[model samples]
Target: MSKILVLGAAGKIARHAIHQFLGQEGVILTLYLRKSGRLQKLAGDSVEVIEGDVTDTRHLQEVARGQDVVYANLAGDNIEEQAKSVVEALEAAGVGRLIWISTLGIYDEVPGAFGRWNHEMLDDGYLEPYSAAAKVIESSKLDYTIVRPAWLTDKDEVDYELTQKGEPFKGTEVSRQSVADLVVKLAQDPTRDVRASVGINKPGTDGDKPSWY
Candidate 1:
């Protein structure tokens, strides 16, 4: 059985990831949230919820210990600090696999008119923190997959594309469900071993590239 730790368990995409993990065999999920009250709906006899801040090393280590994979879905101004805490704790515990959720414009992958808006709207003091967080994860020895998803929508669709590292970012927007599905797929198929950073977005959408080219 694989023991997985999901940080930022209260997030929009994290909710979908939790849904996907349900009923999967050999998998025990531990959801980490800042406040247990926020995740009241996520709890059951099978799911374990841990309350702790990611920036606290002691709390992070306690939650990360004994987990085989850690899925980080955290977002915020202090994201870099939180990521550093997660990386350090995982290293101390000898956990190997890390699946990090990042935004599309973090790598200048957004294109065209909407891309410009993304930059104007989101690219500020927040991005440098995310960049620093990514650096720490990339430098770690653990097997990692950094998933940078395009503009997120609440649509329930699963149609999207996945591009490998160094490839141009595709699509203008992607559903949170699709991102969750890909994360679950990566968890099941270790052979993919997509170590480098990759981008995910919908196909045939405006201001985006197709998933298959």
Candidate 2:
């Protein structure tokens, strides 16, 4: 069985990924979140629910033991610290693969007017730390894929496409479901995109800003 540990399990994308994982056979999940009660209902045959902070390296190391993969769906001003903790914990636990959710423009790879708009919206306090966190993951020896998603939406569909690190980010918005789908695919095939950063977006949605903006 493939054992997966999901950090920040209470998050929307993580929840969607968890559901997709549960639909597959030969997969087991350990859902780790700050508030265990939020995902208590998921505890069952193929799932384990645990309360923990990803920033607590010792606790995260203990929780990460024996897992095949760690999917981090986390955010906050302290995200860089959390990334460091995750790397330390995974190395200590001997876990070799990680899937991290980040945002577009962390690499300044968005182009045209949209790029400037993205920086304006995220530059104040968000993008810098996220970029730092991505750096932490990239510098580690562990196999990692940092997923930088375009503006997020709650739409139920899963139509999305991928862009590599150096390529300009495409489109303006993608559904949470699409991000979750990519997460699930990476977990299922550990060798798919090792040590690479991927950008995800809905095709044909390109604009100066997301539609809602």
Candidate 3:
């Protein structure tokens, strides 16, 4: 069985991912959270929980050791530092696969009027860190798939499409459920491979006018 470590496991997206992975085949999940108290809702022997800050290299290394794949959902003002810590820990632990979640505007790939507003909302300060973090992952020797979702929504539906490192997909929002589904799919398939980034969003939605806008 493949052992997977999920950083920022208390997050909304990670919660959904956990729901999807549980009871699935050939995989066991270990959730890493800064505060184990926040993970009370997920308490169960079936799931392993590790409490630690992502910026702490030693803690990250301990959690990542012997894991086959890692899914990073961490976010904050010091996101780049967190990414650096995880990358270093993964390298030291010899863990190869990583699935990193970042926002679409990080690369200015968002299109249309709303996309413009999205960039304004993110500003350069908020995105600069993620961009820097992505550069680190892109240059690393580890196999990785970086997923940039257009905008996040709490919608329960899973209808979505992906734009793979080509044209940016047009849509303002994607549900947490859909993103979780994609992560689970990626975790199961080694064929997803290294150093690739893709954009994800719901289909049949207008680029200029998203529901949230």
Provide the overall lDDT of each model, using Cα atoms, as 2-decimal numbers: 0.82, 0.96, 0.85
**What is the C-alpha lDDT profile of model 3 across 1-213, one tens digit per residue?**
888899999899999998888868766888899888887666665678878898899878988999989999989988888888989999999999999998787777776787778877888689889988998888888899999986788988887888877676677788999999999889999677468898888887766656766
Q: Could you estimate the TM-score for every candidate?
A: 0.91, 0.99, 0.94
lDDT of 1 by residue, 1-213 (tens): 888899999999998998889868778889998887888776776679988888888878887888888999999988888888888888888888889998777777666776777777677786677778888888888788998887788887998888876666777788999999998988887656556787888887765232222
* Total backbone collisions, model 3: 0
Candidate 2: C-alpha lDDT? 0.96
Sort every candidate by lDDT, greatest first. Answer: 2, 3, 1
What is candidate 2's lDDT per residue for 96-194, written digit by digit as tens?
999999999999999999999998999999999999999999999999999999999999999999999999899999999999999999998989999
Candidate 2 lDDT trough over 10 residues, lowest sum: 48-57
- Give the Å error, residue 60, model 2: 0.7
The true-structure Cα RMSD of candidate 2 reads 0.6
Weakest 10 consecutive residues, lDDT, candidate 1? 204-213
Cα displacement (angstroms), candidate 1, residue 126, comes to 2.8
Better of 2 and 3 by lDDT: 2
- How far residue 37's Cα lies from its native spot in candidate 2, in Å, is 0.5
lDDT for predicted candidate 3 compared with the true structure? 0.85
